[model samples]
Target: MRTLTVFALMAVVLGGSGRAAEVVVPADMSCRTEGFGYADTNRHDSSKLSVRASSNGNKSWIKFDQLGDYDLSKLRAATLTVFLHEGKSGSQQCDVSAVNDDVTENIKWVDHPNQENPAEEIYALTWNNAPGNLTSDMGLLDAAKTTYIDTITFTDGVEGQGFEVEVLDILLADTDGIVQFVLHNSPNLLNFATHDNPTEAKQPYLTLRFAPEGADHPVPEDGAEVDTTLAQLAWTNPEPNTPGEPIYCDVYLGADPNRLLMDKVEVGPDVSGVAINTDNFPNFGLLANKVTYYWVVDCYDTDKGLIKGEFWSFYTNDNLPPEVDAGADQVVWLGMGEDPNQVTTTLSGVTSDDGLPGPYTVLWTQEVNDAPAVVIVNADQDVATVTFSERGVYEFTLTADDGDKQTSDTVQVIVGDSPCDASHMSTGEPYHPADANQDCIVDLADFVLLLAEDWLACTDTLTQCGMLLPM
Candidate 1:
């Protein structure tokens, strides 16, 4: 794992900066050369690439260019795919080599180099051969040569088949980005589709894979101080312009500058940002305040695997007060003769400390007021309920203490008088007749008061006895 991380870092610092790409073999870059002493015959416009032994051994060549600009030094792999249209014999062997020749698609049979010279010796094909098998006798050369690259065996009955060859070294060896190769059958004839084939999809092509580019444009800027522990980590894929499948990102974060002791967080191929709470890493303990933290993002091609990126660092802010958010002020009405507890309002507040290292305290306090009643508060919780015993405006403050510093916010509570207040009776205002005691409404207590005054005839001129009788 350590070695993998180092390699990934080097890739980011080196040439692994471009996206994966594919280059198709163009029609003008492919041609066939017949060896029947017909040196002047031009097969550049043929629809197929063929190699046969019947007519003095025919050979084919395909060249690919514009590959030098890519960072082939860090290339993961290079694949060359050719479509096989048909074969003349049963299981024919072919020799493929990276020859040092100045041949092009315009070269005619008479211009072919081997037309008058002795036929190129061929070698036998071997199974389970390592890549760049120069020692294997490909039957096309008199002695083993470094140019002999690979041997491909073709099945006679199968047609419209595709074969892939790993030609990474060959592509890297070409400094001009132009790669040329020659193919000849070991003994029999074999036909393969060329770039000019009617079926466009059957044309030969090359695919090169490299590590995904490093992360760019990070959030919060490197080597800066952040006020909050809940940092939003973000970065950009260096190869966003490269056309291919989505790339996956793995984020590594740690307090160590070397990033050896860190935690890994896997994100989506589509997501470029994630919020990480440094103070709340599961089972790893809270991140220390005033400590510098290091992080890096490693991107991967969903199909090709890890493409390492660079490392960035940032420092957590020094001791800071907790942030407090007191909920909106509340307005409530007190019913006549209602219990103070029944007329309660909740004072909601939210608090967050940059590095909540120890247990914090949340207290709700009521300021001094002129009302002749006590204010009861559920002081222990962040969201506390306050019961006002008198009708008036009350201000409550919520404070959060995180050992180092304290922060507070205020909320206003307005308690209004109810319409059924007993005090309104003395004001000579109209009131419900059933409210004998003028507390709120008619009830068993009012009936008891009326019974106490039963049979007390209205002898005074101010009393209306007729209305009180029986009715």
Candidate 2:
């Protein structure tokens, strides 16, 4: 278990209160307790901790302090990074519980008379179907003492050694500046690097991300292209408003970036997102394509008059050329024919375009040469069948033209008298002895056919000699 105490580090703050901020702190003290009811065994200064649940196994505790610098109420996200000392093949479950009282560096293995057992496990790890309960002598306590916080599951089979856990709600539940945690009852033995580890980088640490004071984290991201049909504006507001003093936002939007205040919309604080269509704002109508729109959200709280947000912009989708996929190259085997060897195969072509501007048209054209002419059915349709009359390669192109743009794709069709010949013509690969079934590619399929048909059989010497020519 890793506990991030903010007691000593006051210079770890990254940003101001107007924007998101990040704070990182490391565990201040950690110790492992023997599972047996011993009175005097403690490993406080070890560089590694062994956490498990057997009768003789050990449970660990981590303590962190100095979190009095920042207000915990504004914590948006919290994460804990722990490193495994040694790699393991499978996953294990380690139950993390919040300690009601702080544990000192000289804490013993046995529970004292007034030693308050850890409250109901805060995080019940799900591995090997282990129940969510504290099974250690020093960790056992009334299950109803605390409410269930969360369950965190992690896989131990990682290429590297570091693993992180989301502890936002877990940390928010602890109001006290000092944070303490108990690690016990893991399905498998877990060896974790301690705060006193030789490598500072491997020591467990915690990161906290705080939301800005005003509305932020706009949707669609700034400068992103959005669809006009489902256009909507959204943002995040971390500060909660009081019941009697509800918050209101004055949303200003316009196509001209310099004069964005031309249109103003007033919405309640409960509405985090508003649809940008004609139904909501008849004056704004459907947004024009390829046009950039600028907007800003000014939230008004009774406590703090009006807090203006940063101006954000996004471009509407533009009319794009039809995306064409003239299916894969094909191979066809001609049937027995005397005059002209011929076969027909479907050339499946597909096209997609933004229905802006107008409808689109499709055309199929073949490359004319001295070879026998190929006939295409419904040449204007996307998916059309083509007939090959000669044992040669034929090429056809599918072109899609929208009113604004046009695009094309080509596919080749190979015709031959036999399947193997058709495959060889399509691949252009030289035949090999290992291609037992006459296919151009020699893979495990050939091995399976060879093993199934020609395992161990001997021919008669007389027949073999008679069939051979005089040498």
Compared with the true structure, all predictions reach lDDT values of 0.60, 0.65
- The most accurate candidate by lDDT is 2
Backbone clashes in candidate 1 total 12
* lDDT per residue as tens, model 2, 1-471: 343312212236764334457778887755565544432443443566667666566666555666656687889788766666565666566666655422222222222223323353222111111122243443342253322333234564442266566677667766656665556656667777677777676676777887666678888687887767646888875465565667677776777654344477788955677778666555555787777888777777787767666667888867778989889998778863443466778989998888767899998889776446767898899999977666888888999998767899999888887778887888888789888777667998889887867565546565563576456
List ranges where model 1 is wrong by over 4 Å.
1-28, 87-89, 101-146, 215-471
Instruction: Indicate the residue-level lDDT of 157 in model 2.
Output: 40
Would you list the clashing residue pairs of candidate 2?
A: 6-66, 7-65, 7-66
lDDT tens digits, residue span 49-106, model 1: 7776555556666656556667677665676666666644576677777644233222
- Each prediction's RMSD to truth: 30.0, 14.3
